[model samples]
Target chain A: MSTLFSGQLLFAALVVGSIYVLIALGLNLVFGTMRLLDAAHGDIVMLGAYTSFWLFTLSGMSPLLSMLVAGALSAGFGAAIYYGLFRRLLANTQLSQRLEGNSLLLFFGISIILQNVAALCFDTTPRAYTYLDGIIRFGNVAMTGNRIAVLIIAAVLCAAAFLFLRFHIYGLAIKALIQHRQAAAVVGVNIERIQLLSFAIGFGLAGLAGSLLSMTEQITPFMGFPFTVAGFVTVILGGLGNLTRGMAAGMFLGFVEIYGVALTSPSLHSVLIYGVFIVVLFLQSQGLLGRRPS
Target chain B: MQPVPIRTSLIFVAVIGAASFLPQFGSEYVVAVALSFAMWVALAQSWTVLCGMTGYGSFGHAAFYGMGAYVQVLTWGTLSPWLSVPLAGLVSCLFALAAGYPALKVRGPYFVMLTFGLAEFLKFSIIGIEATLGQFSRLIIGAPSPNALYLAMLGLAAAATLITYVVSNSRFGYGLRAIREEEQAAETIGIPVARYKLTAFGLSAFIPGMVGAVMAMRLSYFEPSQAFDALISFNIVVMAMIGGSDDARGPLLGALFLIGLSELLWARAPQVYMIVLGALLVFFVLFAPQGLAKQLFGGARRRAT
Candidate 1:
């Protein structure tokens, strides 16, 4: 009990929570901007993990460099998906209003295709690469170098994205679109370009998270589903489309997960997290940070 | 709410009648395929009853299916499958009765995510329960023959379709559709919006529960993960979409087409089959969101209107 409540557990929770922030950010962005659920978000994460994994295994490139490459590639793929699939759906005026439901199914299909294709291409075996395996020790807590790297990189990526969304012209444009779609368009925002960009960035972030995740955990083709669920939970907890609040929610969930597992057992990890998900949904559908719609 | 056209009814009965004799003359492999066909038909039809009509699409039907399988497994020795199967349905119906109230409170995408999260929650909880009990997996020895299982699945398929048929034409289904089109309006018009949705959800759950029970015995294996596989839910939604969930006939057609396609490709190249299914889902949503059944029979309904 004492060890479970130690500084080590707290640090571990922060590390895991940082990863959640990465996953949720991308999810909320797409949902916020275009009202697309992006059910394939998890599969995009898997693609990123594979991208980093293969890059390391085949060419001995450091995962640190490959994470960026993975993010870039996934961004490209995301843009292509938008152009090929979602753009057409968005074009139909009748469909655009119901785009959330339509995109949910469309992305669900995309996820299935992505998962199966990855499984076929990579096989279902879990793969891992040896990175910085050495452990670093502080006064009382020891942490693996890989996990430490993951945390730092994830934090850096998240902060960069936060600043971009906060201060950049395009970031403000994206925020404007989310806040008022008609008004943003009336004010000269390029709905199509902004939508495409946001979609790509959302996917790219998931991909980047996957790469960082690959450093700390073994990567599998099917690994994205859990992250997808986690990301969605985080998104909901923070209130959809509220990025800063989502980050806080991710960390909060991370603490809850780690401490909950410590209190119970590791096998009950999913149960505890989903319990929180259900309770949050039932008790507060608007999310903890979201204001009730007038 | 009009009665199902006599032509559709005749076709349904004829196809089911032909399928009923399958176990008697068909090979074991044929029986197996037919069993899968029936299972999907049952699943897709029931899914249509609530999700298709009420427009409350669920990604959590797997929870009920898995629950049914779990119930059947628990009752395996004490009760015969004849008893266990209905018991599985009852258990799942009760689960829906309990879960539907809060679950139905959310609408659209929130409803979708909540249902999906609930299913995953149930899956993991079962996994934890099994782990705590020290039972990693359970094997059912001396399970029913494929022929028997096939018969049971075929019955469930027929029963599920019949239920959908009855519901789609009933006032209850009209209320459900009204809820779909506008829940607030439906309530204003004196429909018990909450009660209607909840009943439709529970009704939709019952058949899948039975199907899951029959499938568990057909495989003679039961594991929490396999029982609660999310792919099962995805497949059900895909079938419903492809078939057109507006009525019973659409899902029936969708099942036949996909099952036929799977029959051709699954054993030879399963990956290709999945890729094709995924591609079809995207294509249909993009090109023919009304579904194949609507394309074929949609004309008649429109003409009548």
Candidate 2:
């Protein structure tokens, strides 16, 4: 490929990778901290995209502002799901044994419901907006202003998340819960509040990523499925519950997919991404940065 | 040993007898639906043998099904359906054995994830091969007659049911159950946990492969997307879980229930069927974790009680 094409592809890869990093971060937080596998995380992402899309289309709001709205809404929805669905199931000892399987079916059903609702509302036609069509030129290479903005947002979010987790009281509480739920509870941590906050923030991150993705790509009801798979793969590659590792793995996957597409056919990008995942899993079952369970 | 209950024996006989004569009296459309339901029942039961009894949640069964479909397609073009279908099952069983060997080393969630990855990998490989090789020139497979296909499927389903019944009562079945309950304990008790798990996997794969082969023959077409769809795998698992994975009759009931539900919903409200199915799954996971079979069978009646 020419230098310009290569540069454009690299930039695209970074932007896409950043979105994955954002979503993976959220997934890692929820799954890592609560020890609950939320299969509906992708549906939350789709909700964010559709929410932003509708807002921009109906009220002439900027995508960035719409993203904030979407994030808040998703947080509310996440908390609601935790209270209404997960909490009840978590109470049952026999049910918890098959929680993963149950969660898969449960969230998958929710996903289908959300998708159908979107389809009924949006008419199943893929829609796009020209909110971020401007391009910034650097030498012979050109980059979309929207992409650059997304990269900046992603970087800021990642940095903010890292700082929050490392320094903040609530962040530490979340981590404490992840390490030892019983001990954290014994040490006067409100386990319920922490779980609610973590799930809300996790979903909020997914919503943010979804809004950013929609600015670059067309919005469809079924968009969540692929992104969910991508998020899952990233989490697995990064080591199940490690946030930093998930982000690193997401970026690694994004670059691999982008470069792999450029080198060969774009169709094989999934194969390449999943191929790396299988290899990583085979070699190190826990993943690159996943902690071994005691 | 407890004698086989007359009530249970009579129920089994009645169901089989009804199933055997279904094609003769049922309308063409009814027969078609019944055959389709039977096909899913077979696939679901196959999955139950491994996932329910052995505790190996193989998410890559679509790969085995796809392999069986392709094998049938490859053979039926040149050979007879009778010969090709069994060959498909054998091929799938071999593949399951090979794939399960490495996977059985891992336990719990890791095993599930690996199987999921393998299924996706197989889907990609099939699509890649189809793209690389011209679709028209690569393979030319003929379809079998629907009537013959229906009867063959019925026979296969019966055989699968019988095999499941035999295994559920056999020494091997006890070993499989032990592994499912506690792998370490089973190993300590000399249950050959790995071997029994592999055997379950192989049998599971074989049944689906055989059914998939018949399905391909009935459909008269085969493609990667159709053959290796993750949704098929999901549906089979859901059916087994819904009907009661632990019981032999559970998957069959689950399949029939889902098929009837899908057909009714699709006819009345095509868009809402999926939503309803999803809602039921979630509800069942939360409220009725034991599955329908457990509900029907009364949660394995304690002998003393």
Candidate 3:
């Protein structure tokens, strides 16, 4: 009701939205370019959280230090998955008719594997790290330092990624692949390596987001799928593989969730998110900022 | 390919028939597992009917299953579950018909996302309703009767399979296949693309809706989290694909193998069972992406006819 609470809500949305964008950006890269609907992307995010959680607890590393470890771990896993699993799938384009179903099922399988593995390894306990304990107040408004840090990190990474994709040579290659994979291949763009890099980077970003999440929420093995839904929604709402659009949508979803849950009641948040999610899928399949793949 | 051998059809019928009479020869536990197998078959086959034939992989076909279960929960104290079961299917039918319009428009890979989104929307809606009420009050239709539930599920499964068999062998089936292969081409060739997809979607929804209702009756209690569990979607999609979505027999065998294995292994270590299943799904996708029926009987036997 109060303007101060709304300011607080706006701040919460920015912080949460920033993390959501970070989580989904990697998904947009891999999904937009490679065209694999990596259902396990969310699990990768969860694994990233686990990686940092274990490091912070056992090794007594700071949050910032553990974020790099999580990123590396997830990137390695992504590259390994590409070579061990996805590489074979991409090779089997001969069966053409079954290609789409096969890739989807494969990712779903990976999701199942990762979820159970995390459950076994981490024991399904919801965990959080207390690196930043106090709130930063502005006038009548206050926001947690953890959230502020997450926002800064997420925003900076998103901007850097935006520039990297728009101007960098590898980013150009990724864009070429997204626009016309066959043409890109014919032009000798080294499709495999670029795809591998993109997959690793995408997963690394997801892990980074997960690392950020561990500072704020209770991390759990079960958390990945919903986050998968979140990441998927953000990526789609942002227009398949458009990272900037995904970021914008993530920010939008965060506000709906924060205000919808905090204002009226907490239980309505899922409905609000999913309702908006489905409606958006119907209303703007092309995404808020995306032009059709054509 | 040589008049399409009748032998496979006969064998398919025999499997369904034997399953129908399973309760007579098997123990209570066997009956229970058999019913579970039947439910999976129906779920997988219905999914196969819409997605497999049309080339759209639905990541959240569990929407119908949850709808059926919730329908029972809503009507528990008033109507008999047996009566509510068919209505559950009707509700699912309406939902699919309503959703299929917008959902079917989601081109290419996004189809999976759209379906998944819709299912999640339903799930959250249920949860929202529960939260607003602040409790998951039990809504029992009657006494918990496993035997009747098993028989009912068997019938629904049998019906689902029969419907699939009919669809696969019919002109409509051919239309669905054409759409799967190339929607634009099918549209150009004068197939009513919308009608075919919608009908297939409706067909797929009917049986699972009923099965979900029966599952709720068996559970004796209902909660949004439990009834609309995302695993229902995951398991059905995994089994269908791993078993071979291209044909009915393939997924039937797949659903049986998986449902049976989980029954055996899940008794002690549920996590281990899931891990093994996940590994198999990945292995199957990588190595043997072909359906078992095609592996055994051979693929798309058109032979350029």
How many clashes in each structure?
A: 0, 1, 1
lDDT by residue (tens digit), candidate 1, A1-294: 689868899999999999999999999999898888888899899999999999998999998999999999999999998998888988897677678888888888888899999989999899998899898899899998998998888888888998998899999999998888899999999999999999899999999999988888888878998888788788877887778899999999899999999888887888897898788777565444475211
Q: Report the CA-based lDDT of candidate 2 relative to the real structure.
A: 0.79
Query: What DockQ do the predictions score, one after another?
Result: 0.59, 0.54, 0.55
> Over the full model, what C-alpha lDDT does candidate 3 score relative to the true structure?
0.80
Give the CA lDDT, 0 to 100, for residue B127 in model 1. Answer: 91
Give Cα-based local distance difference scores for all models. 0.87, 0.79, 0.80
Model 1 error, position A194 (Å): 1.4
**Highest-scoring model, lDDT:** 1
How much is the lDDT of residue A41 in candidate 1? 92
How close is chain B to the truth by TM-score, in each candidate?
Answer: 0.94, 0.91, 0.91
State the lDDT of candidate 3 residue by residue for B103-221, as single tens digits. 88886666877788788888888777777788665656465668778888888887888787778888898888898878899999999999999999998899889988899888887
Q: Which ten residues in a row have the lowest lDDT in candidate 1 chain B?
A: B296-305
Give candidate 3's total backbone clashes: 1
Q: For residues B1-305, write the lDDT of model 2, one tens digit per residue.
A: 23557897788778777877877787889889878887887887788778878777776789888888888877765788778888999999998899888777766656776787888888887788887776632333556667778878877777777677777777887778788777899999899887889899899899888887888878777888788888787787668667865547877888888998888887787568767777777777787766787677786411100
Q: Put down candidate 2 lDDT per residue, A118-163, tens digits, no spaces.
A: 7777877888887777988997679888888899999999999999
Q: Which docking category, incorrect, acceptable, medium or high, applies to candidate 1?
A: medium
